[model samples]
Target: MKARIVAETLVKGITVNAIAARHGLRPTRISDWRRKAREGKLVLPADKNAVFAPVKLAVPAIAAPTPPVPVTTIDLLKGDVTIRLAGDTPAARIAEIVAAL
Candidate 1:
């Protein structure tokens, strides 16, 4: 429950005071959870918003230019099944797939 609250505050950008007031908790308690979350002590919910993807930069080669290839893919896993989609897939399409799942 505390982890959820902290995740809501961090991922959804909700103010600690607001969550505390809504849940009848002291703001300080929520702040403590936030600190723990920052310190990797609290386990928050798995959320795409909470995820940080690494970025890589490539230098151009002196050889003839080649067509740029798409290298990223979006993977959705549920149970024992996994679905992979192009990184450039439309948001609406992804939403439909998620809803269907």
Candidate 2:
């Protein structure tokens, strides 16, 4: 009887709350069956008209490290003025130079 109720509740267009209310059972009981089904403990009867799709899984591959991009220099040009700077120059010094220009 419980399995029949569960099957009816699982049918298309049927809801657990509606089936529970109709059968005077708690919604939690119906939901428990659903949870069990999800965990492979409960198996619902297959419908004759049901269509299933094949699932494919790929084996996880090891990730390779990304090489760092090389930073060599910074060039600031304004009109006939050109400022050549190293990539390792301090940000505050760069800001001061920019502010002075």
Candidate 3:
């Protein structure tokens, strides 16, 4: 292929005449390919020296969720007096406390 022949010329020790001789092609043909590449018409492969490896991504571990803590304080104020009780105290008990105050 023209691309392969052109790529050969790009190698450090390889020459257009040598590549043309090896492929039984005219050196002028390879020159034309190079010209086309310079003019943005032909595409060339990556350089042999430029190597790459595939990348792998790892999955992260998930942690167990913690339980929520319950908030447990209620306050009642009458004049200058303050009363504190558990948030779960019954409404009837609160009414009795309020009436006693």
Candidate 4:
């Protein structure tokens, strides 16, 4: 489909505006195709020699592993509690845990 070609071109680093100009398509339509590609809903054409060639789908990159989080240990009258918090940990949950203790 014409839309798929535009999307594949866009995924290959071609600008959406350029694809629109080259294919005589509207820029908005090209943007829609890019969105579909990002969502994995667009079907790209396969090469004859490389049937499973990876298409550069417009997806977000996976974040690298962060450093180990600091663990805070509190000694209570009843018992000692150890709390481990990571860089990605939510502040609200940490507050709740501390409150419960």
Candidate 5:
């Protein structure tokens, strides 16, 4: 019962030191009582109509990951030589063609 009173006083915005002083106990004892109440070891009277303000969590919205686009390359255009190729074209073959050109 004493622990409950100290916990209630602490909940009412009173400092733990002040509550302990008022009850002729140490501040550590009041803190222990508060911890017990928080951990469900000590049950306080439920005030059915006690109103609390709404709380909003600042969580960001998750976005979908974008897929990688296909890549195609090679736009070799010279005086009279035109060579268009895909991205996977072999470097040796391209070098050979360019050497021939």
Candidate 6:
């Protein structure tokens, strides 16, 4: 019972390691108790003087944020020049543009 109390105190951020050691309990047990408390598994005593009280189990929920879309830019100077022959804008027209450039 004393060990549980000491562990609870440690969980509450109180420096009670010495007391826990005196009760023949490892600090890791106190750490586990604290973790259990956060998970709402450990119940603390209702009395103000009590070391621990009963707590409701709580599982934290996490949500991931949506990512943004990528933007692409086309730079004519850096782009490859392709000449295609079609009924409308034929290869001859492209040649004219390149000659003008």
Per-residue accuracy of model 2 over 25-70 as CA lDDT, tens digit each: 8999999987887787777776677899999999999899887676
> Which residue pairs collide, candidate 5?
none
Q: Residue 101 of model 4: what lDDT?
A: 79
TM-score against truth, every candidate: 0.49, 0.45, 0.47, 0.40, 0.43, 0.37
Candidate 4: tens digits of C-alpha lDDT, residues 1-101: 85466545645567777878888889898777767867778766655455565788788899999977665543323266566556455778767777887
Q: 1-101 in candidate 6: lDDT tens per residue? A: 63367345744555657656766777677767767766778765555565676899888787787775543432223246644344345457656766765
At residue 94, candidate 2 shows an lDDT of: 94
Q: Write down the lDDT of every candidate, Cα atoms only.
A: 0.88, 0.84, 0.89, 0.67, 0.76, 0.59
lDDT of 1 by residue, 45-82 (tens): 88765558799989976898787787589998889989
Query: In candidate 4, how many Å is residue 71 off?
Result: 13
Shift of residue 6 alpha carbon in model 3, Å = 0.3
Point out the higher-scoring one by TM-score: 3 or 5: 3
What is candidate 1's CA lDDT for residue 98?
A: 91
lDDT of 5 by residue, 1-101 (tens): 75567545756667888877887889888788878888888887765668999999989888888865755878677788788988777889888878877
Provide the clashing-pair count of each candidate structure. Answer: 0, 0, 0, 0, 0, 7
Best model per lDDT: 3
Query: Sort by lDDT, best first: what order?
Result: 3, 1, 2, 5, 4, 6
lDDT (Cα, 0-100) at 55 in candidate 4 = 84
lDDT of 3 by residue, 1-90 (tens): 888789889889988999999999999988999999989799887776887999998898888888767549779999899999998888
User: Which residue segments of model 6 deviate by more than 4 Å?
Assistant: 2-13, 49-101
How far off is residue 99 in model 2, in Å? 43
TM-score of 4: 0.40
